[model samples]
Target: MTNKHSERRVVVIGGGIVGASIAWRIAARGQRVTLIDKGEPGSGASSHSFAWINAGAKEPIGYHNLNRRSLEMWPRFATALGEDVGLRWGGKVSWETDPVAAEQLQARVQQLQSWGYPSRQVSAQELAELEPALEIGPVVAAEYSENEGQVEPQMVVDACIRRMSELESLILTGAEVIDFDRDADGGIRAVQTDSGDFEADTVVLAAGTDTTTLAAMSNVYIPQAESPGVVIRTTPLPPLLHNVPVVYAPPLGDGRREIHLRQCADGRFMIGEGDQESLAEDDTQSHADDLLSRAAQYLPGLAEAKAIPVPVGWRPMPLDGYPTLGYTTETPNLYIALTHSGVTLAPVISQLAALEICEDVRADAVLTPYRPERFATLTEEQVAEMAHPRAGHR
Candidate 1:
């Protein structure tokens, strides 16, 4: 192996949006790269994603800034990939009916405004004006974050594949990683997959929920909580939402959670209960129909739409509810890029991951707080205390 970074061989495990973006960026930076996926690229969790791109729901000033930076980077990323990727930027509209919920939303909007986010409280009339198609009933309070939007994760993954093709990168789907060849120093020397083996100077584990298991193979500790969510789809409707690309409407009937819906570029509508990281396991057709029924209460246009159930998608959530990025102390040659808002963070995260891999340097200022070493010393009590609480970001 050579000391030149560009000449080094890098193997990226996982072909989801996160891994695909990172691998594409690495190949673009002049590295010999191989991307291995147990299944077809983007057919896993990426396909089941709601693909909302926003920073309004992220808390803590630093994390909010991180998502906001990535949110802003999405456009340039789409352009660089040389594809549409269905990236929309009309923003999101969410309102609450209960007084308590309305107060919480208002406070949240104020906090986001204080952080210079584009979130602002809107009157019920303003909400109707924002998206007139909505039959928003009894809005106690409403907020419109004009910068938040949505994207097509599968489209983005396909675009990455198209660009990586030009970069001459090796992408193997249906090839599972059986083992790894390690050097005497216990560092990754090569990645062994069912398809074959590829020599690796660096390996990135962005395998979504499987990252915890894969990272453990390299003596790296990365724990993830089981976060299964269902975002049902509806048959194509003629542009359901007139203005905004994303909608978070209050739950109707006996529903205990809010229902978020967004129309995809392909004309299908994705509707889901709760937030991005909400826990759910039901993927039955009845559950899908139920979600659509709840959504139709707010958006009457969906009344005629047929429900399409999506398989439960597990979110790649770190135990402490933050991203575990950067190289591990146990295996310096191995990089970890696991996070929940992968769709929102793909652009900036991939650029930073590529810079670190190609230059053999740490993104200290940006990623120091999210290094894999943070979980090394966590106690069992701490793990439970910080377990995936509520979904991350808006």
Candidate 2:
């Protein structure tokens, strides 16, 4: 079959990074694409994303390899979009304070090295040298991966959507997809939105946390767990750390926190803490204060940094904590793209999803493990049990 995806009326639901990327790719292939979103592009999870682009701590060989491949594709993707999406390949450094956790961290690093990943252990002195602004704490062990990267996720989404528009793809903001109009043979004929119904040859559901709800409307079951996360952005500050991102796993205690901090191209630091235990009861300012307090331990400059109004978005994690990609067996014309690392996986997933939809080819070899059919027979209770106990963060 030819690679041309010409004239196919492809309607993409969701205007976040993933959806924007997919719509852009499809439109690039000469497909008639329409992107629908409840809000402006990137204002959903894309806006609140940590935006770290790395496969450093990803588990399982398959998942890690997938991320690695996508990481490699990012630069080329950005270049194609021809926009400054704040894409940076400055690498990443991570460390653990507890001895037990340090051992575990080192072991994981070694395993990644064995898998051909560029990850290596570093001493506290080396870490300090790499990040001069960091106030090195008690680190049992640390690892540095030069291949890691980060991006301004919202900027990337905007770039993709802008390119999609240039390619003649229709973009609908503040238009929500309410349901799907199915043909007699059970294929999606058109997408019913709050604004109006739009006919499409194929419908792709890239809605972040709402993916499960949309899939249910199509008589398909794509189980996703509730994984709420908070990211606090500080007002523009003088450069605090080196270009690279830093992940600190403090000693495990009742009140100890895991903190990740990285600076954007504009000099603003995006700092966030893991686990919801530190979240305030009713005040987001208190949560931001806690994040800043934790961040100051590593970068002393953040002690005086002011917190900005950042949106807290829930991550769309599949029940088994992996991406649920590919189309449903029953609804052949309906494709699903749901995952937590939308920032990291956007480029590759968009390319692959576009190819499958436009060429009508099966990507089973590359996406078999993540297909939605894996959960096709599960009951609602069984699906709920698949969710992680922690149930939050990426």
Best by lDDT: 1
lDDT of 2 at 298: 73
lDDT by residue for model 1 (1-394), tens:
2346667888999999999999999999888889999999998788998999998888788888999999999889999998789988899999998889999999998888889999999999999999999998888999999998899999999999888888889989999998888888889988988888889889999999999888888888898877788998889989878789999988664657898999999889999988777788899999999888888888898899999988888888888678888988888788999998899999989999999889877789988878999999999887776664553322
The digit string of per-residue lDDT tens for model 2 on 1-394 reads 2245576799999988998898898888888899999988888878877788878767688888888899999999999999899988768888887788789888988899999999899998998888888887788899889888889988888888888878878999999899999989889999999999999988999998899999999998888766667777888887766556645546335565677778877878877775322342222887787777777877888887887646667777787877788889989888999987888999889989988887788788888888999999888787666765444322
Q: How many pairs collide in each candidate, listed in order?
A: 3, 0
For candidate 1, the clash count comes to 3
Q: Give the TM-score of candidate 1.
A: 0.96
Deviating ranges (above 4 Å) for candidate 2: 1-5, 249-254, 275-283, 309-311, 379-381, 390-394
* True lDDT of residue 203, candidate 1: 94
Report the C-alpha displacement of residue 231, candidate 1, in angstroms. Answer: 0.5
The CA lDDT at 46 in model 2 is 83
- Which residues of candidate 1, in runs, are more than 4 Å off? 1-4, 253-255, 388-394
